[model samples]
Target: MSEEIRETQQQPQEQTPPPAQETFKPRPPGQRVTMKELLEAGVHFGHQKERWNPKMKKFIFTERNGIHIIDLQQTLQYFEKAYDYIADLVANGGKVLFVCTKKQGQDIVKEEAERCGMFYVNKRWLGGTLTNFQTIRKSVFKLKMLKKMEEEGVFDQLPKKEAVKLRRKKEKLEKYIGGIENMNRLPDALFIVDIVREENAVREARKAGIPIVALVDTNADPDLVDIPIPANDDAIRAIRLLTSRIADAVLEGKMRREAVKLAEGEEADFIPEEE
Candidate 1:
């Protein structure tokens, strides 16, 4: 081949080397949050409360910016960080416990948990639910007893005139104790929606060594949680936003697992079968 032609062939054959592998640096803790943003967050969530104690007032101080506060900002930042942590856990086949102190918080959390296939402490955090797990198991056993009684026609055997009333009362108790029957074990991680309101649950979880992720309002002490997100605890918008973020993290983890499975399947397909 001519020199020019040989040079052209060599140029075409020269490998465009594989792209450089990207290196990922670890993110610093609390790097996602700042003091000013936390202060503003507190102000946004503080407007509805009628009264504030001295500590809360100090934490949620109002400046010339109308009502500068840190609670809302801190809560939001906390959620962001907590969600990031949760995503890592879920990616590793971990579970989360969603607990709320407010009445409706249970239902809200339950809905989210079901959507994400995670656990929740929607019912009252029964004493010894974690420390004495078998004791809580006994409660589940009682639910089995109720089921057995129903199956054996025990309710029908009651006095005919009183049977309906008795059945109604039983149903009421069952309704009140909706999610309690499922609480046979402690959660790996606990997410408390209202830290101030659910302080007892927090204490119990702490004693059991379960990691805690909580939404801390201005009135709540941040030290109670392993991961605290300062935000408007009472506002549905804020709660939904934060909870959804956590749920999204869990879903992302699930997707990652599925992708790995698919990749494995493709690899298997490429393997040669015996001749």
Candidate 2:
């Protein structure tokens, strides 16, 4: 028994492995947002490795299980940069058109744009909507005419067939150009949700010399836009977060613009008109 005890004591005891090294360490909370929030929102998720754009290599942090992981640090940096740019543009009396026609983003884009009092396109992107402004304006005028007729009871007096035809035309126009009816001219900039999906809008905006700020996924080319905020463009929550941030910037800018206008008005009021 003593020999057995000595042997047991001499044998090395099984060593428990140190706690598995933590793969993800959340940074301290940030002012606008924290890395943890972004993680929870799945902003770090990217397209499959096979579908990634090579031009977006720098934005990618790594690959896990054949999926590319976006670098949230870069997302934070670029998002801030885009936010500042948009705010300054609006404050300086520049207009921004919100373009997001994807089903996942349509309602969100429309709501945010309306919240910020900016123009938006939540439906189909008509070819030459920007390039052919005169034609689009005509369509908008037609829509207004149709609405006026309806309000004035002209549709009520018309034969059923005629009224039905006119109503269908009005609905079609409203479905397509209703959002941009108030857009008198080309916007100074564009805030796009998915560049790949809204390629025509991007192309038209580029041709019209309008600067673009867009949320780019790994599958899309980031170089297409002037300011690209790398993020998960498909996730509804991610889209809401990004669009809301941009809308906030627009609202802040509008406030600044109003302040400037009020200051100008006060200064003018204080000045005496020629007696």
Candidate achieving the largest TM-score: 2
Candidate 1: stretches off by over 4 Å: 1-43, 47-68, 71-76, 148-177, 180-184, 265-275
Assess the local accuracy of residue 75 in candidate 1 as a C-alpha lDDT between 0 and 100. 53
- Local distance difference test scores for all models: 0.63, 0.85
The local distance difference test score of model 2 is 0.85
Residues 43-131, model 1: lDDT tens digits: 24543343443445534635333433544444545556787778777767777877774654555687677667776666666667667
Instruction: Give the C-alpha miss distance for residue 143 in model 2, angstroms.
Output: 0.8
TM-score for each candidate, following the candidate numbering: 0.67, 0.86
lDDT at position 158, candidate 1: 83
lDDT (Cα, tens digit) per residue for candidate 2, span 1-275 = 00011111254469853321222121222445557777877788888999999999999999998989999999999988888888889999988899999887888898788777889999999999999989999999999999999999999999999999999999999988888889988899999988999999999988998899999999999988999999988887788878977887787677778789999999999998798
lDDT of 2 at 240: 80
